[model samples]
Target: MKLQQLLSHTRKAVDEYQMIQEGDHIAVGISGGKDSLTLLYALHGLKRFYPNHFELSAITVDLGYEQCDFTPIKELCREMEIPYHIVKTDIAQILFEERKEKNPCSLCAKMRKGALNQAVKEIGCNKIAYAHHKDDIIETMILSLFFEGRFYSFSPKTYLDRMDLTVIRPIMFVDEADVIGFKNKYNLPVVKSACPVDGYTKRQYAKDLLADLNRQYPGIKQRMFTAILNGNIPGWPERIPYIR
Candidate 1:
């Protein structure tokens, strides 16, 4: 598929969600993965002709792992002509040595996302976007269903009450394999997780389990993706009552 075509489809998503608007400044959470790079390039391509005016800034949170440097991503941002920021924290040690439970994906993601939110506010952004694609939506929805017995999925667009900023996922309609294809086509420089236990968490198990299910039932992934989009996704959680 043409990159321009892919970008056009993604732009429609950005428009529908009002992810960006006139004079909006957006901070993109980057992890040096294919999905994030795909988001950066899509915005880079769309910002020129998008009806609403907006800006893109790429931000990466470093877990302060040993010898982990993001200079390559910085340079790629330079070449793409987008401003980049790196927030370094001790996520590696925190995940590995301290508070390292058998199932730590939830906690690690929460802490990292909180830091990213704070950094975006500090940079004066009105909105922030993550690169979670359709597969992520499917996986997360399944995880919530199987483990928590809840039907919950992250919204494509969300508003934080306290900070009063919008959070969005522009790639929510795009698939993960498509993102990988785009990354390879662009020859993007990707950084791999250097952690000892990378991709070994409970979330990985969910991804693997989903893959197995798909093998057993072809086209199962599409059904899950549609379910997340069409079925009950528990947004507006702030309206719910607290129970003992």
Candidate 2:
């Protein structure tokens, strides 16, 4: 997808969820992946004429992976004139070597979020923008249902009362396929994940299952997304009428 198209989807989600406020400063969480990079571009483009007048910054929690390089992402942020910060931590070591946990994703994510939240707070940001998209939303619902026996997914906007921070998913309306297209078209410098279990997680299983289900029953993804929007799930903001 082009920048304009990406911006449109992002703006739709932001406006629908009232994710941004006047004078709000949002820190985009950069994972050096296509989704996060596309989110960086989307919010940067939206900042151009968004009436609420919000500021943008970027943050990445470096998991201390030797193979992951962030120089290109830093340059991308510099080119966009957005302040970028990388929080270095030995999360990989703690999860894999020191802890030697069989299931490390949970702890790794917790540590990563802790690091990212601290960095965001130090930067004086009121909100954090995550790059979760439509496919993620659906896959999460599937995971919750199949694994946990619940029909639950993440909300587009969530307030972390304990941390005094609000997490917003601005690109929730954008599709993952579109994110890949945007990355390819824009030549986004995506740093491959060095984690050993990158693609061997339960989320990956849900993703593949959802793809298969969608192929068997066309438009199932859209229907499921609509259910999520209208499911009256706790924490989800009420849908605002589309203006255009």
Candidate 3:
């Protein structure tokens, strides 16, 4: 996907959810993955010409892994002229070495997010941007139903009263396939994840199940996404016309 196409999709989501306002400062959470990198590009580009005139900064919380280097990400942020920060923590050691938790994703995510959120607040950002896309949305719903016995997914926008932070997902309209395409086309400096269970999680299982279901029934994923937009689930914003 080209940059213009990415901008179009991002604009649609932002407009639908009223995500950005004039003088808003958003911190893009960088995970060194395709989805987050695509989001970084989209938001950085949008900051230039969007009517709201928002500011941006990039941030990443390093999970104390030896092999995961963020030099490329730092260079990318420098090239984009966005302020970047990397919060280092001993999360990997705590989870895999000390605690030895069977399910580390939950604890790891909590620690990482807490670090990221604290960093954002320290940098004086009122909002944070996450790179979750369409595939994540569908997979989350499937995971919820299969594991939790409920129809649930995250909203495009959320407000945390405790932190006085608003989380916005501007690239929620983009697809995982397009994220991969954009990453290749733009040569995004993606830092490989060094986590032990990178692709061996429940989320991966849900993704595989969704792919199989989509193959057995074409357009099934689209239908599921449509249901999410119209499902009236608490926190889900109304669908925008541009999406259809």
Query: Model 2, range 2-91, lDDT digits (tens) per residue?
Result: 899998898899888899999999999999999999999999999999999999999999999999999999999899999999999999
Best by TM-score: 2
Residue 138, candidate 3: Cα error in Å is 0.5
**What TM-score should be assigned to candidate 1?**
0.90
lDDT of 1 at 16: 59
49-159, model 1: which lDDT tens digit per residue?
Answer: 887888889999887776666778899889988899999898778777887666666677888988899999999898998998888888888888888998888888899
Scored against the true structure, residue 202 in model 3 reaches a CA lDDT of: 96
List the candidate 1 regions with Cα displacement exceeding 4 Å.
Answer: 236-244
How would you order the candidates by TM-score, starting with the best?
2, 3, 1
**Please, what are the lDDT tens digits per residue for candidate 3 over residues 34-133?**
8999999999888888889888999999999999999999999999999999999999999999999889999898999999999999999999999999
Off by over 4 Å in 3: 238-244
Lowest summed lDDT over 10 consecutive residues: which window, candidate 2?
Answer: 235-244
**How high is the lDDT of residue 98 in model 2?**
90
Q: Compared to the true structure, candidate 2 yields what TM-score?
A: 0.98
The TM-score values for the models, in the order shown, are 0.90, 0.98, 0.97
Superposition error at 26 for model 3 (Å): 0.3
